[model samples]
Target: MSGLLIGYARVSTDEQDLTAQRDALTTLGVAPERIYVDHGLTGTNRARPGLREAMAACRGGDVLVVTKLDRLARSLPDARDIVAELTAREVKLSLGGSVHDPTDPVGRLLFNVLAMVAEFESDLIKMRTREGMKVARAKGRLRGKKPKLSPRQESHLVELHHAGAHTSAELAELFSVARSTVYRAIERARPAAPSAS
Candidate 1:
């Protein structure tokens, strides 16, 4: 099936380059206008405007192309869901330089295998992070992000909050911090109750 050859390009940060992906698609003869791009947006975010536009633009026999698979999805479930949608619409996917036909059993198997590998890699990262956090906690080094307000400021914040004269918003504004920060500080300042039998 022959139709438009569409391309999608994405960069997670402003510092990264979209030139390479754009050039590759252009070299492959995809018109510059047909190529959609999302700048400074993370791949983990599924609500990318450019991606939405590209998908909306797709029709049966059309191909969705990406320079890399990660540019399309960052997780296994996300990849699987997207492939499922494309297959339902009879749209093909082109990754790197290979065109993958989701209708073919072999291609479906290959994509599912890649999705599982991606999931495994994601799980390994989470496991490593948990281990690191556990070690840090054992050393009394694991903690929430450093407070934006200093100790003196925090004390004043707690004082103002306890006075019951100011709203949390007022306290936050007075302390030049977010209302959530003021609430957290107030919570931390709660007195311990007498022990129960």
Candidate 2:
């Protein structure tokens, strides 16, 4: 179906030029007004304001264009999620010269596989973080930005929370601590017993 040729462009910093992306979309016949641009946003974040606007502006029979897949999203899951949503809503998403069509059976299968790989990568990040924490714990350092409160204060908070003598808010106020700190302390102190056979 013939649809509006809407384009999205992003540059990580104000210092970076959007010339490449802009020229690409221009070549694709996307109007200047229909081109959405976000400046100074890192690709690691999917919450781009202009990108969100472009997605919201899309409707059935609309075509979303980007210079490339990387310009559209930072990761496989991000690409797949956006493509899936567009496909679901009867919108078509394409990079300027890509023959890959998510609506095609093969493309859909490939998208699913890529999405799984992205999920695995995310799991790997978590596993590495847990392992890092384990090593840090073993070293008695935890290798992170330390707590805002001193260990003694946090220990006191946990004790008070356990004794049920003070609510978290009260503890925070009494100890000159943030409410979040008191809550976190309680969580750290809460029992997490292993499953009994």
Candidate 3:
């Protein structure tokens, strides 16, 4: 008797669509019902609930299918760990319709090569992102998250806080901000303490 075909898919960002991967998996013989997915989760994150569920769903002789090795793991160590787990559990891995035979030397080599490529790609992405941010910063365009409250609003909030007419909760409600925000604004308004000589 043949075992079940379990499918897994993932996307690094919420904006990225999973339709292409899902279609590919279905075309490769994975049933839609058996497909597990993780959204807005990076491959480098090993604690994905979807991946865990798919692995747990597999039994001896069951095949775990993925459209691409990168979708399964972005790092070589993670890929190796996953393969080790699968081998120990007697589960087979099918990458893009090609079943990986751990017992074969060539298959092992190919798997390692694919994992290295994935890791390289991930490293390149990180490097490019850092360089891009550096350039943006040099051009004065890489300002981080904007403050939640405007300068004028923050000043008024601080003034209201100093007035002591309202409690922190009341100030938060009045300003439509959190109590922490109120506290931060007050803290910001404080004069800097004298430095020790």
lDDT of 1: 0.83
Q: Return whichever of 2 and 3 wins on TM-score.
A: 3
Pairs of residues at least 3 apart in sequence or in different chains that clash in candidate 2: none
Each prediction's TM-score versus the true structure: 0.59, 0.54, 0.74
Q: Best TM-score goes to which candidate?
A: 3
Report how far off residue 29 is in candidate 2 (Å): 1.3
Best by lDDT: 3
lDDT of 2 by residue, 92-185 (tens): 8766745358758987786567556655665676689899889889998976677788888777777767677888789989988789888887
Clashing pairs for predicted structure model 1, backbone only = none
Model 3 CA lDDT for position 94: 99
TM-score of 3: 0.74
lDDT of each: 0.83, 0.78, 0.92
Tens-digit per-residue lDDT, 106-126, candidate 3: 999999999999999999999
Off by over 4 Å in 2: 109-197
User: Candidate 2: what lDDT?
Assistant: 0.78
